[model samples]
Target: MTAKIEIYTWSNCPFCIRAKQLLRKKKVKFTEYGIDGDEMVRAIMAERANGRRSVPQIFINDVHIGGCDDIHNLEDQGQLDKLLFAHSGV
Candidate 1:
């Protein structure tokens, strides 16, 4: 089974771009929420992100994975792929 990946972002945010790039490099499929100038959507994303109002909030299989740096850190630690391919029991 594949992991369910999601990312909240603004159209022009550099971090968001970088995060997406990393995911693309990994060849992981993801859902992107581009909340550019959409405060309502941003607020929803913030709520989902534990009150973090930052762009590029990421989630894997409904688990919050934080922003770009956080994902990169996970990659550096050799854990991102594990999470990306983990199978959850339904």
Candidate 2:
């Protein structure tokens, strides 16, 4: 089974665009929640992200993967693929 991928973003946010770009480049399918000026959605994202109120908050198999830089770091460390392909127990 494929891992479930989710990302919270804001329209026009550069970091959000960058994060989505990376996921697209990898041909990964993800559910994106665009929270442009929407406090409720942003609040939910923050909660899932352990109170991190940042754009481009990501999740793989319901596990918080953090923001744009964090995802890129995982890719740079050669660990992104592992998480991408991991099966979701949920």
Candidate 3:
């Protein structure tokens, strides 16, 4: 009944690593899609990210939560935990 978290990342991207680190530190399970240099996969991620062709696009319960700084910003504002602990009606 937990929220389903997903992230699109590039293997060597620092932002991606930082984002994943935060998620791991929180001890939450998330699905990570490592796009690397695959443009087709990147295109799919971009579409899900509202045309944002950046690495480390995040989603919580299928809701777009933006990139690394965005997730960190949510955590800073005391909102990330709310999303992480939510029950998805899926």
Candidate 4:
């Protein structure tokens, strides 16, 4: 039940780097959308993020998980693993 992970980011963003680092540390493969200077992509990401216009927006199994700090907080709370591994088996 490997959950599909996705992230939207701009190049040279530290939060994106940190987010990817966490995924690497967890040994997870994810799809990354680098939206450098692309307003349309950023707009879509913002809409998906509930108006969060920040880089490093993340999703797991289509569930919005937010940026690096949000992810770290979830991990600190011992819940990131659950999100990373959850699958509907569909």
Order of models, best TM-score first: 1, 3, 2, 4
RMSD of each: 2.5, 2.7, 2.5, 2.4
Better of 1 and 2 by lDDT: 1
lDDT by residue for model 4 (1-90), tens: 678999998889998999899999988789999999999999999999999999899999898988999999999999988888766332
- lDDT per residue for candidate 3 within 1-90, as digits (tens), equals 567999999999999999999999988899999898889999999999999999899999888999999999999999888899876432
Tell me the deviation in Å of residue 29 in model 4.
1.0
| Model 1 error, position 48 (Å) | 0.6
Query: Distance (Å) between predicted and true CA of 58, model 2?
Result: 0.3
Candidate 1: list runs displaced more than 4 Å: 88-90
* TM-scores for all predictions: 0.93, 0.93, 0.93, 0.91
Quickly count the clashes in candidate 4.
Answer: 0
Q: What is the alpha-carbon lDDT of model 1 when measured against the actual structure?
A: 0.93
Off by over 4 Å in 3: 88-90
lDDT of 4 at 50: 96
Candidate 2 at residue 31, lDDT? 98
Q: Scored by CA lDDT, what does every candidate get?
A: 0.93, 0.92, 0.92, 0.90
Local lDDT at 59 for model 1: 98
RMSD to the native, candidate 3? 2.5
Question: lDDT, candidate 2, residue 11?
Answer: 89
